[model samples]
Target: MGKTYLYLLIAVAFEVFGTSCLQASQQLTRLWPSLGIVVGFGGAFFFFMQVLKELPLGITYALWSGLGIILVSISGWVVFGQKLDLAALLGIALIIAGIAVINLFSISSPH
Candidate 1:
């Protein structure tokens, strides 16, 4: 993978971690956990900003935000016993496909 993709991955990984931590942080009861989430999110956003240098804002942001939401939701289902029905799963799949299409086929990307 290219540097841009690597950076994007880093951002995603950190963001997922942060989001998971946020869940652990319940109503300020888990202050330390919440602090960790803030730190993780800050780092992820920093890497995301770096990735933006090599890709179009619309394309990069679309994939980043879309994939991140799906991953976070999936994580919630798996880790927290949250309900994920067929529709949500299919929607996540569609989002992934959309990101793939944007990255692999669309000439709309500035890169």
Candidate 2:
């Protein structure tokens, strides 16, 4: 279970990197950032597949996407100077709450 979580964390990190690179890619026009998208997403999917071996799809996807969204948003805000409005912050907070609930209470997920 700990190994599963490590895989999930790695997957999320790669996903966030991919998403960040996607923004930096500038519509796929830039060279390094565009290549980074491929490498990041590829690594993400590879590790995500490992995670899926131990966890259910629905729960895994929820956790994966939730963390990815939060990390990517932060990356955008900090690295790209993107704006995060009050509503967006509220939404992110809600996502955090949802993830907490899942980790805390959901039997389908490993505690």
Q: Candidates' TM-scores? A: 0.90, 0.97
Full-model lDDT for every candidate: 0.86, 0.95
lDDT of 1 by residue, 29-111 (tens): 89887887988799899999998888878888897888789889988989998998898888988998998888778997744
For model 1, the local distance difference test gives 0.86
Whole-model lDDT for model 2 versus the true structure? 0.95
Off by over 4 Å in 1: none
lDDT of 1 at 13: 82
Query: Deviation in angstroms for 94 in model 2?
Result: 0.5
